[model samples]
Target: MIALLSAPSNLGLRPPQRGSVPGVSKAPEALREAGLFRRLLDDGATDAGVVLAGRYIDDDDARAPGHVRNEEALVDHARRLADRLTSILDAGDAPLVIGGDCSLLLGIGVALARRGGAGLVHVDGHTDFRHPGNSDECASVAGEDLAAATGLHWPAIADIDGLAPYFAPQRAVHIGHRDDDEELEEVRGIIGLVVSAADAAVAASDDLAASVVETAGTGYWLQIDVDVLDPEVMPAVDSPDPGGLGVPELTELLRRLAPRAIGASVTVFDPDLDPDGRFARLLADVVVDALRTLGTAV
Candidate 1:
């Protein structure tokens, strides 16, 4: 059975204006409004209930270690989220975590690590491996999630509950990154397989799925940041990259990939930019379709 978990945290996205409207934090409610949970339940999933995070506070302090904005809040939220995920796993129901941003990947990583380690399949537009020292915008935790998950960043976030390198370097696969940053090269050195967007676009779905499953080992978590879709179809993200996978392509990939995952997360979709809620509905349908595929796999 699959259960939906809502982790509405936007601490990772630090808006320049203090009181700017929340983006990713509104994703869970938006998706729910689009009938995501109902559709999943109708397709045979049980309601796992929502796990709400604390309110998001934008702290402009540059003095935080690693230049992480809302560092304390981020750490606290991650810890809380880890606990929630562990409980979900203990219940034996696959979790469909709806996220605030990519930073929630840290919490999910920690949860899997505590339960005896798991592989990570990161499907997104950016590598999300930037260190605070290298980034021009020094405060967004969203940009550093992969680094923290791999034990490359601050101990507070990386070594949650005294665990470090949540998943082994060899057990992680990053797919669909388009950025040409040095961090992508750095991640390539550590991650087992780095499938560029161009490579994934050309590769057969079965081949790509086989590679990701083989690299991720027996158990793994799948993370999908909606920005992986082309801007023409998914322009509601904070940073939309051009020339991304089409919705059909991503859906097919997920159908092949998700069946091997212990759980999955959908992140970085900002309903604020999607005024008509078209993207939300599209995202909801994709998730429901993936869940249906997963049901068949199990």
Candidate 2:
């Protein structure tokens, strides 16, 4: 069965400069209020409850290494989160970890590493491979998740529990990234296949899913950052890049991808941006439908 795991974290987002709202931390509750868990339960899924971790504590250190915000809290949270995922997997349930932000990828990576490594299917609008040094004032850990997961960044974040490069470059496939020139250049230096948003637009969904599965080998972890969807449909993310996949396109891709995944995560849906709660409901439906496609639900 698939278990819904809430990871309510906002540590990865940069602190509000002033008078800015903080709401990603509340995604888990927001999604539940929108009946994500109930819908899954109606479809025959299990509720794993939430994984408690350190609360979001914004960092004030501008000179921190790699300019990574909330370094200490992030590290601690990753450790605890990894432990929780490990427990769920050990119990033989597929975990559907929700929200916090992309930085929670570190914990997922660590858990997979403990199980002798796994492939990663990264679906996002941005590549999320930016090295900390390359980022500006924001220096959000959410933006650097994929990079850190692949060991392209600091050891503390990348090498958690001495498992650096959680998934080898050859074992990962990054899809749907629409990044700028410099970011694309950096991504190119990485040792994995990057399928741009444009490429995904033209490629057949089955072919793309097959290619990703083949690349990831036997088992893989799927990460669906909602920003990967078009801003028109998913405007609840922290950074909504333009020109992303439509809801139907993303749903088709998930149907093709989720079966091969051992576990998966959904991130970056900010309830504050979705004041009317419409986007939250839409996202919940998409995810539930994907889980059903995975055969984890009735």
Candidate 3:
């Protein structure tokens, strides 16, 4: 069975404007309104309820390195999220986590680390690899989550409960980042498999599935940042670079890849940019269609 968990956290992102909280926090409710949950429930997925987030403390021109915004609150929320995920796993249900932003990876990492580890398949338009070592603008956890998850960031968020390196670098596969990504070269050296969006869009789904499956061992966690969709198709993300996958291509890849993963998280879709709820409905359709075959293996 699939268990849908809503993690409405915007704490990971910088503010769209000064003094304003990011609206990605509304993503779960937006997706729900678009019938994502209803369709999943009809298809045998269970509503695992929500993991509420701490209030987002905006980072307005604050380039304070190593000073992650909402440090205490974000840590607390992650720990609490871990507790909830633990229960969902205990029930033997595959988790479909809907996110407010990518920072929820911290919590997911905590849960997976406690579960004896799993491979990570990161599908994003950007690497999310900004760390103190590479950049001074490391305040947004959403953009730096991969670094935090792989234990390349500060000890505070990266080493929660002393479980640093939530997913081993050698067991991780990163797909869909653009070739021009600033962190591409560096991430490639650290991550086991790194595929650019251009390459991933052209590669056979079967081949992509084999790479992730072989590296994932017995179980794996799939994480999707919706910006992987071309801005023409999905512009609701915090950062929408050009040259991304089309909806059909993304849906095909997910169909081939998501089924074998133990759980998945969909992140960075902001309903504020989707005022008419068009993109939300479209994303919902794509997700519901692709994940309906959740437990089927490659």
Candidate 4:
């Protein structure tokens, strides 16, 4: 069984409504509005499809400045969210979380850690492991999520619910990163694998079943930040990365991978950065396809 949860807000960065990134869909909200759970429940009853345990994180509103600025609060909220997600995964169910931001990785990592060590396949344009310190770059806390997960930087992040530094450095892989920065060193410092954009596009589509099987063989938790897709294909994401994976490649990858995991959770962040619904639809298809593919593995 797999449960779909939506955590659709950045506790730190609150964009306006209908402000999805260019290529990704804002379907999470629409799914809620359209009574998606009822439809899924009905579908499951008829088809014995994967179960949908729909949930949304109801924490301090994203717009609350205190919540936004409080690192302790953000980390705590992530821990609580992880606790809920952990219950689902612990029951031999996968969790597909539609995220509020990349920050949701905090919860996902924590949940996976409790269940047992899970490898991470992080598909994004940034290495996400920024060295922690006082600097202009350190102001935006969300930027360093991957870094925090690898057990570097902020004490608050390192201590989330006492699950500090949630993932193993060697087990973490960064895929589809086109833009490079100082953070690359941080990733290397943590000894995370760097899978380049060209390699991702090639691997995500070609022989994806093999790729998934091989990757999953290592026991991984896959997390895709929509920004990893080219801005042309998914333009609505915050800080869209140029020249990255295409939709078909990404879809194929997920379709191939979903079946082989011990458990999996996914989060699509920064949908409000998208202007149209095209990106949302693409992301939704990826979810639908991944969920459907699980049947083949059964």
Encode model 3's per-residue lDDT on 221-280: one tens digit a residue: 889999999999999999999999999889999888877888899999999999999999
Model 4, range 31-118, lDDT digits (tens) per residue?
4444443444444512112212223223334534322234555666677777777676555555666565676677777777776667
Candidate that beats the other on lDDT, 1 or 4, i.e. the better one = 1
Candidate that would win on lDDT: 3
By TM-score, how accurate is candidate 1?
Answer: 0.94
Q: How do the candidates rank by TM-score, highest first?
A: 3, 1, 2, 4
Q: What is the C-alpha local distance difference test score of each model?
A: 0.82, 0.81, 0.89, 0.58
Clashes of 1: 0
**Where is model 3 poorest over a 10-residue stretch in terms of lDDT?**
57-66
Instruction: For model 1, state the Cα shift of residue 209 in Å.
Output: 0.8
lDDT of 2 by residue, 147-247 (tens): 88888787878898799988898887888777463487767667467888777877899898878877886468898899988798888988888788888
State the local distance difference test value for candidate 3. 0.89
Choose 3 or 4, whichever is better by TM-score.
Answer: 3
* Model 2 lDDT-worst window of ten: 289-298
Order of candidates by lDDT, top first?
3, 1, 2, 4
Q: Estimate each model's TM-score.
A: 0.94, 0.93, 0.97, 0.76
Cα lDDT tens digits, model 1, 1-298, are 7878898888787683765745898999999999998888887787666666666766664455555866777788888888888998898778889877888988898888888899888898888887754666656768778888888777877887888999788899998888564588788889988998878888999999888878986468888988889899889998888978888888889989877788899998898888999889999989887656552343
